[model samples]
Target: MRQTGAVDPTLPPGWPAAVRPPGAPDWEHTAVAWLFDLVPPDYRAHEVLRRYPVLLARFARDHVAAGLEAARAGWRTVRVELADDLPADAMEAAITAYEREGARLASAARGVEAVAGALRGERWVPRL
Candidate 1:
């Protein structure tokens, strides 16, 4: 197993670094810092995540999980009912587009989950 006290080396520079408590490396703050590059300066989500990372984490876990489930269901529908009326290759195109968008949303959700993990105050490292 990887060392819990070690920060994930894969994390880009300036990501919130965490280690064991007594000083758990302030890793939770990294999630907020990480968002700046992904979103606009005035984005309201940034403010909420920055000020209340734990809450943001919980909200993300709850809502994003649901959204992903719904997305999966919709994707299933698209796969099952291939369209004869729509443009040729439309199903493939739609799946590709959905995969791209879903990956982005999943990345954001993972960020909040990472922040929540940090809040737990155990020896911290990113799960590979």
Candidate 2:
């Protein structure tokens, strides 16, 4: 099992020392620790052990999709800030792409939760 508080020793090239990825609460630790609170002790020990790889893979994919959405949103904001100089068609396209990617991330996150719940013998009730 991947330790929640374990840091990734290797950093990507050109990554700033002080800069961390968006939604990363702590650069020195994996987000697994945060998830510990969501599961029962017994479930955490076993369910996480069994389902961690799937959960982590889904999480990574969702994180990447979210990052792409954020980048698109940031670019849109920058363009808007530049006195509406950005092309309207391009801006709309970017917004649509962001929404689609955001939806994908949302779906992935829900999938992770559902899998966790199933592993812990809890019923997964999707909202809508």
Candidate 3:
């Protein structure tokens, strides 16, 4: 891979700090590492993902989006489904956990998208 200049400080929202902006030195390596962090440890066994970073980005994006969806679904159904078994305070805590997880996954989704774009050779330019 070709090496580029220094990293841009003005990264867009949801851009992961672990990944250098596209074209920076060893940026692809860092991007691959960050993408692997989002996936299951078992995924590390896959040589294809290691060889091809763009595919890893796609997998991370889908995984994060699924997690966000699962969090939303749990948040919607927790009250009705578990109200009988769980105490009110426990239920409240569960809801709060789901909300927090949902927000985190949403941000992860954006981050994965940005990383995927970068892996595909997209560059970020700062505005005036």
True lDDT of residue 42, candidate 2: 60
User: What lDDT is reached at residue 90 by model 3?
Assistant: 99
lDDT of 3 by residue, 21-96 (tens): 6767888898899899998899999999999999999889888888899999999999999989999899999999
lDDT of 1 by residue, 17-96 (tens): 33122143544444545544344456444566568756555655676667667666667777667676457588788887
Q: Residue 63 error for model 3, in Å?
A: 0.7
lDDT of 2 by residue, 1-128 (tens): 32433433442222222324323555223334433323345645565443564464344445545665675676567556744665878777766776776664554455345443433445433343
- Give residue 66's error in model 3 in angstroms: 0.8
Show where candidate 1 strays beyond 4 Å: 1-7, 10-30, 33-51, 80-85, 125-128
TM-score for each candidate, following the candidate numbering = 0.54, 0.39, 0.87
Model 2: residues with Cα > 4 Å off, grouped in runs: 1-78, 81-85, 125-128
Q: Clashing residue pairs, candidate 2? A: none
Strongest candidate by lDDT: 3
lDDT of 1: 0.55
Looking at model 1, which ten-residue stretch has the lowest summed lDDT? Answer: 13-22
- What range of 10 consecutive residues in model 2 has the weakest lDDT sum? 10-19
Residue 106 in candidate 2, Cα distance off native in Å: 1.2
Model 3 scores a C-alpha lDDT of 0.84
Clashes of 3: 0
